[model samples]
Target: MIRPATPNDAPAAIQLLFLAMEDIARKISGTNDMQVVTHIFEHLFREPGNQYSFENTLLYDAGNGVAGMIVGYDGGKLHQLRKPVLDYIRWQTGAGVCPEDETQAGEFYLDSIAVAPGNQGKGIGGQLIDAAVARAAGEGMRKAGLLVSTDNPAAQRLYERMGFKVEYTMPFAGGRYHHLIKKIDNA
Candidate 1:
């Protein structure tokens, strides 16, 4: 079942974020950087007013004992000038891996959408994305956007199939990693 996440869901959301990040990092860097990344992601994405605001969603797979989550941000005009520069510094410092870009196609931002490894390939991800878009549209957003790691083509293809188009790609300091964005119209 898909549901809107409340503040009470923070703990579970943090836990899930940790699990998802560890899984991805193991696949990508294979280092012990997951904890650091997860902590930063949780703080920046969930802790509103620090720099931005987000509307997060959670999916419960009662029958399969799994849960999925989607985190979306408002991306107000303030972010255009502030966030990209901040992200650039963070990326340079090896504190994070996000592209510094300004998106005008959407008022809402889907930061990260993750499904438990054990329950992947069951369409839970699509459901979560759909729900998030609906919520954003309901809130008067004309479009939605998200970023995916460029190395993860499987996820990029999935987003493309869902009508997301790549907007930009920025290489990490190592030049081996990149972040890609896809913009979707709610209308």
Candidate 2:
């Protein structure tokens, strides 16, 4: 069952996010230490309206615990909470990490999606993507977007199958990423 993430899901959600985006998290935190990353995530998860907040996450609970989660927000509003997030990271990690230019204006950005390694290949990722897109459309967004690392062709193909097309390519986290977008037909 997929549902909105609650504060109680913070630990699991953060773990899933770290698993999916550990490279980026490590880059941002300036340390590969997950304890530092978890500290940063814990701060952001409790703060409403920020990118990593629980308010912006949706979880897939597969009977036992959180099997997966998707985090997203409006592209235009993305910067509203940037300063605080960066400040928190800087304070904790001793240096601030540069934010990646991942989303475009006027789109609902699907920030991160991750399924437990043991639970993958079971269509949980696709369900999370579909649910995120539907939530974006329901919020009256015209498009939905996400970044797929160039190294991950399987993920890219999954996005392609879901009707997303490459809008552009950009350098991110010392690697190239394809920014994919899908038009959300709210009607």
Candidate 3:
């Protein structure tokens, strides 16, 4: 079952968060240390209105436990939602950065998605993505967008099968990525 995540879910969701962010988590956190990154994001996870807040996340519970998670929100609200994250990073590490915008107005952006290590290969991820796209359409967005690294053909193929087409290429999170978009027909 996929449901809206809450602050209470942060502890269990921390690893999933790291899974989604991967190395970009290090870049944004300004530390190569997973412990520091986990601490900082756990703090943000408990907060509201930040990009990493539970307010924008959905958790896939596989009866026994959380199997996956997805974080998405209006692309137009990127700057507003991201401010707190950047501020926290600066405060924690004394590094200030404004990475290239990964999303923009007129779409709902899937900022991150991850399947738990133990639950992967069971199709939970595709289900989570479908749920997120439906959520976006329900919220009146005309498009849903996400980024896949150009180097990951397997992931690119997966997104393509899910109907997300490459709109263009862009540099994001210190890597070249293909920005993909899927039309929200019902919206």
C-alpha root-mean-square deviation, each candidate: 5.6, 1.1, 1.1
Q: Estimate, for each residue in 1-187, the C-alpha lDDT of model 2 and write its tens digit.
A: 9999888888899999987788888887888888888889977887887889999999999989999999988888877756677788888888767767788678999999999999999999999999999999888999999999999999999999999999999998788999999999872
Tens digit per residue, CA lDDT, model 3, 1-187 = 9999989999778789788776887887778887888888889999999888999999999888888999999999999999999999899987646678999999999999899888988888899899999999999999999998999889889889999999999998789999999999999
In the range 1-187, model 1's lDDT, one tens digit per residue, is 8876655556566666555344443332223565654445455545444322234455554455447877665667535433542563365344433434434444566655777777789888899888878877777787777666666889888988987777667543333323334444554
Count backbone clashes in candidate 1: 0
The lDDT values for all models are 0.58, 0.88, 0.90
Which prediction has more favorable lDDT, 1 or 2? 2
TM-scores vs. true structure, each candidate: 0.64, 0.96, 0.96
Q: Global lDDT for candidate 3? A: 0.90
Once fitted onto the true fold, the runs of candidate 2 whose alpha carbons sit more than 4 angstroms away are: none
Q: What C-alpha root-mean-square deviation, in Å, does candidate 2 show against the real structure?
A: 1.1
Comparing candidate 1 with candidate 3, which one achieves the higher TM-score?
3
Question: What TM-score does model 3 achieve against the real structure?
Answer: 0.96
